[model samples]
Target chain A: MRPLTETETQTLFAKLANYTGTSLKNLIAPLDNGPNADRYVFRIQQSRCYYFTKTGKFRLHITALPILAEHARYKVWVKANGEMPFLYGGHIVKAHVGRWSDDCPEHQGVVVYSMNDTPLGFGVTARSTQEARRLDPTGITCFRQADCGEYLRDEDSLFATS
Target chain B: MAPTRTTTIKSKHATNKSGIQNSKTSSKARSNGSSGDGVSKKSAKSKRTTSKGVALGSVTGKGAALNKLRKKRRVYTERELGIPTLNMITPVGVEKPRGGKKGKVFVDDRESMLTILSLVHAEKDGQIESKMMKARQMEEIREARKAEAEKRVEERKSKLDETKEGLKKKRKRASAARELEGEGGRREEEVKGTKALKLKKTVSFA
Candidate 1:
């Protein structure tokens, strides 16, 4: 799979939160913006699974692009094969944000985490990508906004200490 | 409302008859008039009613002529007799003279019996209907009580289930704790038993 674009990383986490009640934090990867590169690689939290995509961010509410684009990529199979597309996510809606440094190799884009790898009492594992793929909800709606503002990454991030 | 349709025929005959105005007045006073009987109130049977009572004191007033007529008939029969006859004197074992005459006896016919039966039937039918209504009301009360009982039973069942679940959780925790504590003791006892048996065998061999 191609890496997730910055938009793709954002939308994936937002959907992970929407589909499950929790979302991922800091599971973002930067696309080199190299002509050959198409998107970024990001992981969603809760049900720790992985995905490669192109477009959006995790909003307090759901926004559409990354999900729409992801749907579009595998949507061809659903259209032609009349089968549902699959989901790819991970478990860490609580990944603390790291420095998104243009200076480091891994610190370029967004960083996200998974909740499943965390224990049960701590949080819950979202359903696996396989489970999400089997979901045959009728409406495959898209996003209303393209860019979602920044999300708080830590408990301290809320008040920076509050 | 007249409960029954009936026409009663009453005939007043002279029970006592005495031929004097004073006696007749007393006689009229003697026959107490039935209330609401218009004819009697009007003094309609004044003479007959008067005469009957009048003669009750004297025995020789209203029926004096009938007495004479009966005597005359008996005399005539005696004169016309062709056979030997006994003298008109009292004889032993003969049931003789009571002084007064008795009036005719009146009676109700059989059809009145049917009216009485019909009235009784109507009263009984009403009683039966009331009894049935009472039974239905009692049945309704029973059903209401049964429903109340069922609701109470269900509430009790739910409460019991909650208590059982709580007890089960508590018991599980207690048992798990006991098992952990007992583990070392049980293992130690087993080791001691094995050592004692080995010692016994050694002693026996020696």
Candidate 2:
């Protein structure tokens, strides 16, 4: 899950438009990558996970599918982080290559819908990094995957309005 | 060699004590312990692995901004490992690897892509299940092979012991035969007795 170079990006966007029946602008819209510097945002349902980079050669979203979830233990490099157990049973559906996820609708959590090739928000939850700040020590960013959309500050939490 | 006269001085206690020898042996043992004993280092490590205010990688208990940074830093992708890879990112200024084929995420058909994505998702789950079952099967095979090897080793060892015992008995019997030859070699008196006895028998018969 390397970051797309400008050329790769263009190619991916082209592919997205080709497959989604829309242009890159139509599919991606204005998720906004301008003031954010290396940060890129795309809608994956209500869930919004944040990733920061001094280097942006690889996409954080792609890495997350294998690292955070159960089916992502495909990479030998990732198994070293002591996270192989959590992701061992989970497998990622190659979004473009072939058809795979027909019978296992209940197993949608194991499947990842790519933003570049398929339905971007197919099964993504509307979570933020705020609740997930407890896992970070850097204090520069945070994440959340809660259905309630709770944002955590320094020793404080702000609940989202319904 | 010149000191032919021997004089013995008796201590307060007549008994010869090995206290000095015992002390030297204990001192040697103590020196060995100081250099080789791992007890001190083990204790120190026990103290360090136990203390924990926070886990650096857990991404929990850190402030909002820090949590996000840690998550990004620990990110591992196909690009990092430099594998034959495919991904979609904003490719505006990012250069391609030297001589590597530049790939793009293209949609020739949206409806088809959506259908394909769903299919891909299903495929990934089945693949994981199949992989797990395969690993289990392989492990069972390895265990069976190991058990068979161990059984063969034990059988060989027992056979060797039996051969050694047979050799031991053979050696003992050969050694006893040599002892008997040594005993019978004392034949000087018997030779004289044999000659004298033969002469007396002939004289008595005459």
Reported per model, the fraction of native interface contacts reproduced equals: 0.00, 0.00
Model 2 accuracy (lDDT, Cα)? 0.37
Q: Give candidate 1's TM-score.
A: 0.19
Interface RMSD of 2: 10.9
Leading candidate by TM-score = 2
Give the Å shift of residue A64 in candidate 1: 99
Comparing only chain B with the true structure, the TM-scores of all models are: 0.30, 0.29
Instruction: Write the residue-wise lDDT of candidate 1 on B136-171 in tens digits.
Output: 566579789999999999999999999999999999
DockQ of 1: 0.00
Candidate 2 residue-wise lDDT, B57-156, digit = tens: 3445555457456445356775785533333363534754677765645433334444444454345545545644565566579789989999999999
Share of native C-alpha contacts between chains A and B (below 8 angstroms) recovered by candidate 1: 0.00
- Candidate 2 residue B81 Cα shift, in angstroms, is 70
- Candidate 1 stretches greater than 4 Å from native: A1-162, B1-107, B173-206
DockQ result, candidate 2: 0.01
